[model samples]
Target: MADNDLEIFLTARNVLVELRLNLAKAVSAGYKKGETETAVKSLIEVQQAIDVIDHASEELEELDEAEHDED
Candidate 1:
């Protein structure tokens, strides 16, 4: 648990939290507004957010492994 590692993790966590909140807002707004465009846009956003989180997870795992190897 180096300071750098902790900072990276917390930043990623915050980004994920924000992404989820936005997704929720998009879903709620799309449904309430009854717009097909909004629904499709939300779907795109969901995929993009998932991809980002997935990549971040992989990167973090690699970082963890590298840190352990150094020790």
Candidate 2:
């Protein structure tokens, strides 16, 4: 992978991690505030975001491996 692509991937991964953490905190706070419905919705959205990021990461790894195989 190119240096810029690697940098972008790392940055995106970091952002996703931070976002997940923040969403978890929101879920907890929402529950404490008795907003169960909103909390559940936020949790679902968070899970979706996590799944997308995981899928993308896997695809990137596969692409990187294929690039290596061509050498």
Candidate 3:
């Protein structure tokens, strides 16, 4: 493992957890149907989730590369 591997993993884990929670909240808040006013808010959350997922993926990939490089 690299020096920052733990930090990278922890960050990714946190982002993934937040993403799941946000998605759940959006669903629970009536983000599914078009008639609801919360749909827009849900869409914003979903967009933010996309960025969070991307960031987490990058962090994990960096960690993977570091580990493999050490092997």
Top lDDT hit: 2
Per-residue C-alpha lDDT of model 3 across residues 2-70, encoded as one tens digit per residue:
436656656666775676576666667764455344645655765676676567667777878887899
Question: What TM-score against the true fold does each predicted structure earn?
Answer: 0.52, 0.61, 0.49
Q: Which model, 2 or 3, shows the larger TM-score?
A: 2
Lowest summed lDDT over 10 consecutive residues: which window, candidate 3? 31-40
lDDT of each: 0.68, 0.70, 0.65
- Please list the residue runs of candidate 3 whose C-alpha ends up more than 4 Å from where it truly belongs after superposition: 1-36
Q: Best to worst by TM-score, what's the order? A: 2, 1, 3
**In candidate 3, how many clashes are counted?**
0
- The residue-by-residue lDDT of candidate 1 on 29-50, one tens digit each, is 6555556456557667756766
Q: How many Å off is the CA of 44 in candidate 2?
A: 1.6
Candidate 1 wrongly placed segments (more than 4 Å): 1-34
Q: Model 3 reaches what TM-score against the true structure?
A: 0.49
Please give the distance, in angstroms, between residue 14's alpha carbon in candidate 1 and its true position after superposition. Answer: 14
Q: Supply the global lDDT for candidate 2.
A: 0.70
